[model samples]
Structures are given as structure tokens and as C-alpha cells.
Target: MDEERILERERYQIEQIRQLELEELQVEEVDSDDSDDDSSSENNYRTSGGASASGEFTYDTSLVALHSYLGDVEDTHNRLAFLDGGAVLKLPMFYLEGVVLFPEATLPLRVVQPHFIAAVEQAMTQVEAPYTIGVVRLYRDSPDYRRPPRFAIIGTTAEIRKYCRLEDGSVNVLTRGQQRFRLRRCWIDVEGATYGEVQIIREDSPLRTPREAVGRLAPLLNLRSNIFQKQPLYSPRACRLGDWDGNDSDAMSEESFESELSLHERGLHQSALFSSYHTIHEPTSSEDEKLDPDGEVHQGSSRLDNLLGPLREYNTGRDSAKSALSGNSGNLSFKRMKADKCALDRLREVPRAFWPNWVYHMHDSYTLAQKAADRWKHIVKAPSMDGFVMKPDLLSFHIASKIPVSESLRQELLEIDGISYRLRREIELLESFDRVRCKTCENLIARRSDMLVMSSDGPLGAYVNAHGYVHEVMTLHKANGLAVIGDPVKEHSWFPGYAWSIAECATCGSQMGWLFTATKKKLKPRSFWGIRSSQVADDTR
Candidate 1:
């Protein structure tokens, strides 16, 4: 079937589909069509059969509405899953910030640039009307960009949505998402539009979690909103996940709670909700306390142990925490509301021990813990990220930004087994750089508030200025009246073998901070690093 002929059949189906609309349509649990199979309509690639000879087919949800839902899928418990063995795709990296599919509308896009034009040429020669178009999401501010681009494989699966050409040499076409897919690999074209290989995805079903766990976390979301230090303002309860609008359950309006959630990039807001929940819950513990049935303490050797210990005993058989990962079970090609409900409930019951490792190591752990430990209540408000209000907790964007680290140095960080050692070495070198040490190197301890700290890498981030201070230049060390000097390297109290590191902005060569060094002998529990000349432009600013 050719692209134009298939589109003509789609046009006919749209009319019949409207008349056949029901309260809710049956979307195959996970719509997957793999060409490697028999090339049937039920798979990824098909030579024929999506349409009938009379040009009649089923009408599903509009692409636009589907796209809206994709954006709003909140609660990590409800995310879609990766699809394996589907038709493979090769296309230019979509540069558009984002693209939406409008069910019946056959969109016309120009394919002018060389590599993309070649992609179209290849597609034209294929047997299917359209092979497959992967619509991925992008974060770009090309004209006056503040940061490097962020691309994620969270796009819908679309068969050939439609195709048309104008008098111009560009390919005019309509593309639609048939299902969501992941980017297998991304590489730039000779002309620079990013391109990649992608695999189609299918929505997952409800995950398993202990019933007692849900019971433990749910009401507690409201009970001592302030004390669950392990959870932050962005947690579900803080965002009124505990007191969600009843109408939102099945509501289909533009402003329904679910719709609003699905549309927004929620991590930052979830962070806020975790913050808000703590304001109301005044609990005694800062850590996510776990309880064993026999009332014995469960200080496991590792996190997975602590998380699974009590649950394993309670759920000895098949009926265990089946709710923990419903969100990942592949669907017929779509997900259900009931499954999402189960997943959310399981998240509530997750033991502090079971939480992901990143939670323990995050930079904001202590601040979040302090919010929960104090159980200090603030306003119970669900602030949406539509306006993006809070200051970013960590120095993000700096990860990929060109720091002093060379390609080999950066690769070492990537390959390192011990995260702390990598950081310590990087800090030591930064502290020793010539440009890093300034007049402020002396009296570092005296100037505390302005310095940055990393405590235990702990629950509250207790230490300050640990990374960027010119410690040796500062005079906390007592200066004896002994002028018996030899080599400056061995004699100077402040001098380590190397220099300190200075942090300068990559976009503009302005100084951000200085990273101080600490060897085993110099390891004081409380030493910190300092921010140097604040002449650099911070995106946050």
C-alpha cells in the first residue's frame, strides 16, 4: 500500500470512527506490530491490512489528545515501558521542541536538508506506506540558548500519519505516533540534525507492592506531613495526591487533575509536593523508618536487603507485593486507569529501605531531611511547574558543560567505581590550580555562610565549602617565629604538591568558584570549598 492510498483509507475511517465512538474505546492493552513476525496488522511493519478493501477501519483517540496524556503521566509508578522486537526506525533527530499528532489531520512537513531528505528517499522505497516515525521530546532554546539541549526518548509511536509534496523539492508529509519508543542510539548527520535508531514501546500495566506498605504510606501522607525527611516536597502527598480532586478520577476535561499532571514535566513539582507534605506531617524520624513484624531492628548490610527484608517474610508466597511494578508490565499497547491506581498505591507503601539509591546520594538529601525531620508544616499547596518557581537545588547543567576536565578525565569519571574517590581527585586538582587560589583562601572557616558544604554526603548536607576554598593560603594554622625554611613545597604550611582548581563558565570565561584540595593527612571532617568571583552567568539567574 502506498502512503497516499493508506491516507485516503484513513480519511474514510475517520468519518465512520466518529459515529462508532463509545464512552471509552478498547485500545489493545499494548499496540505492537513487529515486521519480523508474519507482517500482520497486529505488529510493527505490515505490507497491507490496516485498512479494509472498502476503506473502513476503526477510529481511535486523536493523536493530539494522546500526546497530551503522554506529557501528563505523573507518579513514576505509571510510566510507559520499553518495546522490544518491533519495527526498527532510522530518522534525523527531531529538532522541534516537541510535536503533537492530531488524529485525522495529515500534517505536511518539508524534508529539505540533505540527510533528512535521504531518510525520506529511503522510506519512499520501502514496501509499507510509511515505515515508522519516532516522535521524541526535546529541550532547546536555540536562538538565545542558556544551556545545552536535553533530549529524551519519550515520544509516541506513529505509523505513517500522512504524506504530500508541494511544488518545492521538500517532502510534505503527515506523521503520527503509533506507540512510544526509546532511542537506541543518537548521532549527528553530516549537516547536523541529530538522527538515531529507535525501538517502539508499549505501555505497561500495574506493578506489585505490599498491601501493608500502601496502608503505611497513604494516610501518613497527610498524618505527619512534615517529618518523613526521606521524602521531599515533590512527593505525591505534598502535591495533594492524598487529597486529589474527586472529579479528577474519570474527568476528561482540559483542566482535570490527571490531564494537568500528564501535561507538565513534573519532577521539579514533585520535588515541591514532597516539600509541602512535610509541612503538615510532624513525624519524629528524619529517615524513612522501617518496621519488622517481630519489632526487631533491620539494619541490613545493603539497601536492597533493608527494603525487601520485612516484606519478604510477610509476603512469603505468590500474593506478595505484586503492586510494586504494575507500571512496567507491558499492555496490549495501552494502559488502564485501574492499573495506574494500583501502581500509585504501591509507591505509598515502599519502605525507606527500598527507595532508589539516588535518593540517599542526592545533593539535596539533607535539606529534604531537615524539612521532614522538623515536621514543620507550611502551606499545603500543589504548586504546578507551569511557572517553574523554585531555585534548582543542585549545580545542574555543569555536568555536561566544559569544566577543567578533559575528555580522558571526563571518561575516568564515567568509568569510576567509587564515586567519592572520583570527586575527591577532581576537587584536589581544582583546588590546586593557579587561577583558583585568591586573597579569600585565608580565613575560610571565618567566612562560613558563603561557603558550600557536602556533609556525609548526608541527610542534611551538614558540611560547608568543602570543595572550592584556598585552604592553604588562609591562616588558621599557627605561624611559629621559626624562619628555618628549606624547599617552599615542604616548608609552606599552605602548599600541597599541586594548586587549587578554579571553576569558570564554559559559555563565557568568567570564574564561578575554586575547588580546594584535601589529602588523607589534610582530611578534617569540616573543611569546605568556596565560590570564587561571581562574574559568571548562571542560567538560574
Candidate 2:
């Protein structure tokens, strides 16, 4: 059987385990009230960024990126699936900045996550987007810990409606929650864990506006500021930017709730400090805003850059990939070079890793190295550099937390030349941490279900299998897009990548994973293979 088929079976097993776990967790939470107890269950401690009195919100988003991402709206088929599920998710449980993706609704969010930072960079530098993100509750310190870990529990189905890399490296995400999905289970690859499957269990109702709750979002904004100051409610910045009307909360009826809240709702909605909370329509203006953060860059420029960046690198690796495919091993040729990309245009939301944050000139260094590799052989192909690793040491640098695993090792990896015995040994060491984070922020895609994927804007290998399952690691001959990777006929599986069907994110143009590859692979290439996430069920082990 092909690798995807095997992964499908593995994912099946995971689904069964999660079903029982969720059921049990529900039963256990019936009368629990221990704040510190289940608080740490998944990831529950939200940041100090509660609703501020003066609209103060600091994201430490030195890692933010303002970039345009292309993502497809959850079509009618996907929307209908959610209505049936009644889904609402609370993820990264440590503390979720995430919201519900109601059908027909779009949300704009500011993200400063490490993985997302990387994602934004890729979107700007590589032209990627409209991908799926796995969000689970912060359940690190829960009692029923051993059930089955899942990144999909009560997950939100989202599409990138708008994304921007702020001037401060902060990211603004405009997403629409299409539906809700509950975890069945999650499969883990030797490299990392992959989402097994989810049950679309929520149907969305029209965003009902209770009359009294009907005010141009300005009043509601003031009321929100007064109430949930300590809870995970809106920040002043969010309220200002987020256009909402009164009672975005349908949980309470306007008539009785309004009457009861009369004295409280007086001038301030007068509803004392005890309230509430709150898609995505990409207007032409917003679309233009997303694409050209400051109008300095164009969509074509970004896409061409992304497409060229990898193909250029592939050309350098052409010989080895070709040799590997043809079963030939040798004193492979290699190159020593540098490639760097400056935010020539003041792109606001560049990821922190790429921003001049951790290591100065880091992105520049990488880009230059990549460019060096590309140009080293341009007019006249350089034999010495072809099969060689491009800044292998720099590639492996700890771009994640801005710390290197071993400066010496990275140093050695970079200085070394061919695949000599010494180079081979060093390569192995460099290759040690092959698994990329599906939980991303820094040039990485955080782990998720099958069919979902991320590109290798970083080392270890871009294009990680975010589905959180072990990949079949198919060796392809060229750089390709998810469309080709997700085709069922190509992989011969019943499902495309992991979803029954998939669509690319229109905003960022990140190849939403599936069985397709519009990306061109110059010579020798390889790709990861896994099951589609839509098919997962109770894989209870």
C-alpha cells in the first residue's frame, strides 16, 4: 500500500481514541470549579493583554508580519458541514487569541505568533496562504492528561480573509470561521504529530442583532471596555479597528436581557462590568491593502519571488536529487554562498525572525546565501556548488526562538564543502532535527491534520507536513504546489491530501495543501505524502 493509505489507517486509530477522551472530559467537567486545576489542561493562561482601560494592547509581536495572503472562502459545501456540527473551538489552550469562525462571518486578528511570523514571511517572500491552522485548548495541566493529545479539539475552521505584516513586525489576520470541528484523534509522525480527523458539528445561525444591542459598534465598544477588563475580551486597539454593532453576542435576548440590564445599560449600556464579545468580506480596498502593505510591493513581485527562490535552490540541488532518484552516489559537488532579502519596502508585518530582531541580518544572510547559490551557477553553472548544501549551518540555526543549537556545528556545516565522509557526518548532524513545527510562528507551520502543509522557508526542510502525521516522504522530481500533491488519483487515495476537497487561500496564495503542485521543480525533488484530514473518524486506540 502507498504511504498515504498507511497514514490513513494510523489516523483512523487516533480518531477512536479522541472520541472517548472528549466524551470523558465533558462528563468530568460537569461540576468542576478548580481554577488552577484544569486551567493548565491544554494551554490556558492568556497574556496580560486583557481589555485595557485606555485601549492598550501590546503583542510582543516584534514577530508580526504584514503581508497579503491568498485564501479561499469556505465555500457552501464546507459551510454546510459546520452548521451540522455546531462547532466552537478554544485552542492552544495555554491561552487562545483565537475566535469562532461563524459561517458568512469574517474576523480580523492581529497575530504575533512564532509560527505565524514565519508563515507571514513565507507569504510575502514565498507567496503562500489560505492554509489551515490547528488550534487546541490549553490543556497542559489537566487531570485526564493521558487521553490522547489533539490539536483539533473544538477547532475553528478558518480562512484568511485579510493578513498584514505590520510595520512593527506584527501580523494582522482577517479570518473567517467557516465551521467548528471536534477532535476524533490525532496521528503523530516520527517527525511530529498530525491531526487525525474532526467531526464538523456546528451549524451557524444568522448573526442576530438584538434591537437594544443595535448601536453603531462605537457604544458597544465602550461597554466592552468597562466589563471584561480582566477576562480575555477585546483590547482597545481591537475594539477601535473591529467594526461591531451592539449585542454581537446572541447568547442573550435584547428584550428581557436589555430590561434586566436597563439600569446597567443606562448611558453606558449601563450594563456594569460583566459582558461580552464578538468576517470576512474582502473588499477591493482591503484586498489592495493586504497585497501591498504600503503599496511598495505588488502581488506579482511576491509570487514571482516565491516561485523563483525555490527553483533557484533546486537548481543547485539538481544533481543530488537526480542522483538520488537514479541511485547514484558520489563525491557530490557543492557550493558555499549567501542570499539575503531586505525588506526593501517597509513591509510592516514582517516576522520577528526575519525582522532585524534576533540575529541582525539573518533574513538578509539567508536570502543572500540563497541568492549566492542561485547566481553562483547562473551565466556559467558552477560544478563545485551544485550538489553542495547552501548555508546548511545557517539553515539549521535556531530561527525558532532565536538561539542556535550549536554555533560550532552550524559553523562547521557552512564551511564544509562536498559530501565527503566528514561532510556526510556533519550533514547527518545537521539533518538530525528534521521535523519542522506544525505549530508555527517562525518560518514554520504548526502541526495539524493530513493534507495540510507548510513550505520550508526555514531549515530542516520547508514544506513540513502540518497535518501532524508521519509523512510518506515521496521523492518528487520538482518543486510543486499542493494541488498536485493532493490529487487522489496521483496518490491513488480516496481523499485529496487530507480534506475530501481543498481550496487555496486566495489572500496569501499559500498552496493550501491537496493533491496538486503547480510549483515547478527544476530537477530532482521530493514531497511529503499523507492522508486527507476530512476522512478521519474515531481512531480511538
Most accurate candidate by lDDT: 1
lDDT by residue for model 1 over 1-541, one digit each (tens)? 6957955764564443333322132211111342222323342322211111111212121321121111111111111232454657665444333222211212224456556565555554444323444544444434246778766544444344335443555554444334445578878766554567876543222112222122112222323323223333222333233322232232222233323343132333233223322322233444543324322223442432433333233323222234435544332222343443343345454332223334433323233323322221111111111121122111111121112222223323323322233333333333332221222222111121122222111111101122211111111111111111111111111112212334323223334333333222222211123232212111110
**Off by more than 4 A, model 2:** 1-108, 117-134, 140-152, 166-170, 187-196, 202-541
In order of appearance, the predictions have TM-scores of 0.25, 0.19
State the TM-score for model 1: 0.25
* Tens digit of per-residue lDDT, candidate 2, span 95-129: 13212222223333445555445543333322212
Overall local distance difference test of candidate 1: 0.31
